[model samples]
Target: MTVANGSEPKDNGGVTPPGDVTPSETPDNRPSMSDLAAGYAGKAGLQRNSAGHVDMLKSAGGVQGIAESILPGLVFLVVFTFSRDLGPSLIAALAAAAIFTVVRLVQRRPLTQAVAGVVGVGISAWLANTTGKAEDFYVLGFFTNIAYIAALVVSIAIKWPVAGLLFGFVRNEGLDWRKDPERLRAYKLGTWIVVAVLALRLVVQVPLYFMGEAGLTALATTRLLMGAPLYILGLWVAWLVTKPAAQPSKPSSSAD
Candidate 1:
């Protein structure tokens, strides 16, 4: 027994391993699909929570979320407000919205995020179809107006957010979204365009409001609150306009 005990014990039975975690009893406290999706929808103002901090549209800050959700729509609003007819304005808006949608697709952004833009377009269209005369539509327009104002305020307050989002998408396209030297000259042009359109909107509104054509005035001031077809058109156009190049002009050589 003393000689046999000199060697170490060997040939023991194999041990079994633990099984994979199942959905019913997973140890990790990760969120489920609905919870994760709700978080994302909250970011874009597509959905809100019960206490409402979870959903942007439901939250006090949701209007900005909506505005940030669709950049081209705001730009389209600027364009539409100045146009003579709701029909053309709606067309233009739709054009711009379409482009924004395409850019999202090309960039491979989240599918749900892209669809949220579609929801805005639908609302715009319903308003256009009902026209400003409908009481319910006017109510909707009131809220939409609030959304625009809120967005405008947010864009100004957090000015870089929009540009950052844009350049982020552009960078994905393999183009350097940011300019070297970062001059504001290019952005100035868009600013001027918005100013001119805003003035035009005001100019048109004066006569329409005075003439007693309330719908026309609403069309001018609110940019066809009920005109969805035009919204789609505008979205398409915005996509087409394309961002101006970020490159600065190079100095010519004096050797010539």
Candidate 2:
């Protein structure tokens, strides 16, 4: 047997030379899960098999993505169930939803963003009045209006990193609370107006709760004080709902 350098091999039990084999490459050489985990480990400066938690943010949104994930529907469920007596003001919710839908169409936003923004705000507003505190009602509405957007952005950032950037666009640009300056302020005033109306409704509800006409029905309907299970649940969720995401640690350059 004879071996040659950098030459094609001849038949008859001959050995091929060095550089005789050509490597085939294709675009479909996708990375394996181990490769991806390894890549993230390298990027994050993690040690092999270290006792490190899986970074969901790197896996998902980082922060804002987690917020957007659960907020919209939670706000919706809270408002729709508690504020069922809004009656005509229900149109406010509907109109906001329709107009926001059109805004999405004009801006060519994701269908879900538009839907969530409008409907979520409306429902959140309705639930804002459900709080027993009259003075804080509008203030709560104004703030909660923005919460779901924040939440949606957070959730998307976590569950789907790619889609999360879009969430930021809608929150920052669509809401325009910061740059526009007046948008959040306008929401404040609008909240006040709606709250005033709700306040009036509460006054009227007083008679119903006090057994003016219907005794048992009115008693069941009124939730002015915060001792009830539903009210307590609302306050609990509200408290737990808006906490910030845990911050990831940065790599230290110096030795310990």
Candidate 3:
């Protein structure tokens, strides 16, 4: 028997196809993790463009968000450069973050970026204060990047790239994408790009930190330069790599 959409009708004993199950029946037809994953993957496979993925990236934080992210660090660096004092520098950074948060609140903008900026500044300041060294302010960032790089590497080593899983989760794209060799390859490449950026930050800043050459000013500068800017590039690279695979497959032409 043919279904209304021209597909063959199922021969099950009165059991409907999953999609045909009514919303009211969801409780009785609760999908398994594998089913959910398949649905997510199927959606991505059906997409005709990369717009959804782009929107997901924008929602996380766009260029303006990135600017907001680095503002507190920039303020700290400038203040420390002149005073060479940890206390004042910490206050300045925190104050800047507070002001940014207030501005965002006033504008009714998303608080995710502002809140995160403030938290990061607070952590760095606390580290510097506890350690009694101005250079220690950068410690949090260095280790954070190391952890990220390690996680990405391990995810890839396990044959499940962290970047891909995140992208899928964010976009509601399921594990089905992994079944496609091309899409999977694109995800792997994207993961590598992110790893490269994180590694670059550590490679440049770690030496300076240990050698005492970074000081407060140079370390701040390095952190600012490597922070949101490099991350944005990585985001772009991921988007670019996955764009092709996200495009819908073109219909094959019949013989003329």
Candidate 4:
């Protein structure tokens, strides 16, 4: 029997059509490119509200998550500014991260974000302490931005724009959007928007990083402002611009 799309239905005991089959059906059960892309999008923490719009706050990991991300850097900046001591500044930052981890544990929530925050803070602290330069605390962030920009650019170059993989799944378009030239172009533009965000961070922050301890306060402040908040703004814009056009409804036929 023909389905709603006017295609004959398969008869493999309700198995998904070949085009829709996921990697789990394969002999090795290895994930396909689509599965990998979808998993990346899922882990990105982007969420949709009941209205079907991207929830920016939720995507930034809610209030607690935002605090977890910002508190450490803010503590480091404040402590360093007042005491002019790298040791106490690093310790305060690490303490903030640890406190968040403890809070997550007490609440029995998923520890991934908390644990990652702690690790990142620890690395930053270690790097700064080892270098005996407070400015070095943000070095890790520079590398992170570079890595993300590189990956996003490569995805665009390969024509598998990360924005398409991400928003396509979020919007329920799946991989089908790749088949539409207009959708593909829109997604490419979306990917470039994200790329611009990452590049902007480097362009603005890397200069401050070279200014050494003299620019530490400004560097930390900008880092806090441009971190999650800037990222969410860019992602929101990308999501909006890449939105799929509404499908035209087919006219119904009257029965004779």
Please report, in order, the local distance difference test score of every candidate based on alpha carbons: 0.38, 0.35, 0.66, 0.83
Candidate 4's residue-wise lDDT over 147-204, tens digit each? 9999999999988999987777666666888889999999999999999999999999
Among the numbered candidates, top TM-score falls to 4
- Work out candidate 2's RMSD over C-alphas: 22.0
RMSD vs true structure, all candidates: 20.1, 22.0, 9.1, 6.8
User: Which wins on TM-score, candidate 3 or candidate 4?
Assistant: 4
Per-prediction TM-score, please? 0.32, 0.22, 0.71, 0.87
**Cα lDDT tens digits for candidate 1, 178-237:** 243232233333333333343444454444444544454354435443233333333223
Candidate 4 deviates by what RMSD? Answer: 6.8
- Pairwise lDDT winner, candidates 2 and 3: 3
- Model 1 score (lDDT): 0.38
Q: Which digits, one per residue and each the tens of the lDDT, describe model 3 over residues 119-223?
A: 988998998899887777778888788888888888788767755655654454546557777778878888898899888888888877876624556767878
TM-score of 1: 0.32
* Model 3 poorest ten-residue lDDT run: 1-10
